[model samples]
Target: MAEKKFRSGFVAIIGRPNVGKSSIMNKLVGEKVAIVSNKPQTTRTKIMGVVNGEDWQIVFLDTPGLHKPRTKLGEYMMKQASEAREGVDAVLCVVDGQHIGPGDRAVMEDVARMNCPKFLAVNKVDVTTPEGLMPQLQQLATIGFDEIVAVSALRGDNMDKLKDLLSGAMPEGPKYFPDDMITDQPERLICAEIIREKALLNLREEIPHGVGVEMLAITKLSDKLTEIHANVYCERASHKSIIIGKQGAMLQRIGSQARYDIERLLDTKVLLKLWVKVREDWRNRTGDLRAQGYED
Candidate 1:
């Protein structure tokens, strides 16, 4: 009998803002490893989601969208996306099917500059027409991608084909993560992200970007329950008030939604205590950014 061959590699998902990269990551892993929002740049760091199969394990690195940086934090996000492309076995360049604009071209150009196996996934195909998609496909083809696949990350369209393409691209190697593990992020960090995601979903524009979630402490009170205290940091006092809302109504709503998701994620009862604090100009402050897990 011949020995079975096992394959494993790192695959980086890169794209412009709100191109459904995080959504695809969740679809691939069959779980919410990265936070998803209709808001652009919802992902500010590289989040790893592991996909284990019978003979292959793909560690997907979901990165922040590539864009021109306007602030210190934005610059850091762009840098993180660039760094994630290095040495990956494959690059999954995602693009929205409704329209391909300058942002998509710029991201494609960046991927072209990298020496790696690259594949293009035209995402959100369910929302666009074939006539509307031809130009985008033609434009993407001009960039010389190894493969182009049309998929709706939300609807799970043609994702199995994408998986097969990725599996073939990966080189033979031992698995980097255990089979049962789904992601590399710590539970506390994921909890913080869940809180931040709830804030992003409930709050209006500008408020979500100005906010950050920090896990102050997480204590395992018993087998069935855990106590988590977190602070929601905003860049201004008005933003703090916006998050707290009238008589803490907004804060309560955010807390309830986040705690429920956290419980589902951990499979335990979560006692989540949330508070809002103001940290003036945190986006530009190195110390503040570093404290909030944004790399300097």
Candidate 2:
């Protein structure tokens, strides 16, 4: 008798800003495929994380948080989140457990309008009580979700159960990617994101929403070491100074931290070179937006 083949499909995780959607994606994939920060709108693109199981493979997409757009870039990010729902096996609409506000309701309404197999994932359950969870889940359920799962993306609570549920919902199909692969993102893109995340962490509120990291050069120096040169582009000279810092100290710190994380992710030593440049309000410029990989 022949052995049985398994199934695989795509699952999109959507939610409002700072709602732990990226955290849940990282936890689900067992790796940091998406960057996590306390700041809102940190994730600005669609990232693919592959979860391999004994009998199934799930290609999970971590999208930018949905919100009311105030700029072209914000609108693009929202569009990316909306587009993820078009042709996926399942939609995991993540919401904060502690607070069920209008933002969560707006995203739930958008998911309902998709008319797909949707599930509600209440994240940050580690911070919520059983009593609080009940009301939140009940409120979200009324918005028309097919299933509900409570999970703590930070603590890994109920993540396995969530995976099982997602895998069960996938249609019978061959694996989209190999089991050894964890993500479909390019190494340069990942490196750029790592640098950007480090900036986001270090700069905090000093930087604006138009910052982007461009990998200018990457070269293998030896079997264990690589040389990388990247430029951080901002909308103004003042923002550039903020990123570069006094006596270039801030940029050095950002580069060191980012290089350490990149080395761990790539499993090799890296020499990171960082530069800050002003693009003069690049967020609204078509050419600049395309260069930053945000062009839709």
Candidate 3:
């Protein structure tokens, strides 16, 4: 029998804010490498997740949601999304199946100019019927796509099919990542993201987007215990108060929720200590964005 050639390449997943780009990438990679939230712009940078098949490896770049930049942090995020599309084997543009709006159109148009094979994933199909998806499909038909698949990132519907299409798009090449490895994100960054995800889930609407988590220190206290100190940066003192909550209750809630996920991710007990600090318009400040790991 002839030997099989290994295939591997990068695929950038880009879409408008709150379009479930992270959710789709997580499902495709079969792991939660990026954080998810109901809020727009939950992801602040390009997160890479690697999927290894028997003879193929797919490197998925989960980029931040494409949106207008209002601050330096937003600009960095937009730049990350743009840079992720360059030098890739394919581009996977995800969009909401239920509501195909102008923002989605804008994203599709920008991606249309890219010089690579493009795949459109109409996500959240579980919530809508085939009939309900018609308008979205019709709208998407105007754009050029190599393949379009309807999927529910949360329900894993048609995920295997989507995976196959993505893997098939790869040219025969080297395995970019090992079989056991899933993501390229560092432990500190992942830890910080987990904390941020928890905060986004629990905090008020206006508070989550302005929030940034910085890993002050991460220490291996013992073989079974890891100590993580993080600072949750908000733009104003009032926002800090809201994050901390009455009698430090809200902060405690975010810490407890984050510690659970961190422990699972690290496979060790974690002592996550979080402190809420006000940086006064940190999102617009270049130094603050750099401090929060948003620098590009």
In candidate 3, residue 89 scores what lDDT?
Answer: 97
Q: Each candidate's lDDT (Cα)?
A: 0.89, 0.86, 0.90
Candidates in order, TM-scores: namely 0.96, 0.94, 0.97
Give the per-residue lDDT of model 2 (tens digit) for 1-296: 99877988999999888889999989989999888887889999898999988889999999998878877788888889878776898899998898879878988898877766888898898999989789777766777888899999989999999998998888889988987788877888889988988888888674746678888888988879999998899887888888888999899998999999999987889989887888876666777667667767
For residues 1-296, could you state the per-residue lDDT of candidate 3 as single tens digits?
A: 99998888999999999989999888878889999999899999999999888889999999999888988888999999999988999999998888888888888888888888898999999898999898778767879998889999989998899778988989999987788889988888999999999999998768898999889999999989999998999988899999999999999999999999999988999988898898878898887787777766
Candidate 2 residue-pair clash tally = 0
- Sorted by lDDT (best first), the order is 3, 1, 2
Shift of residue 159 alpha carbon in model 2, Å: 0.3
Residue 184 miss distance in model 2 (angstroms): 1.9
Q: Model 3: residues >4 Å from true position, as ranges?
A: none
Considering only N, C-alpha and C atoms within 3 Å, which residue pairs clash in candidate 2? none
- Which candidate, 1 or 2, has the higher lDDT? 1
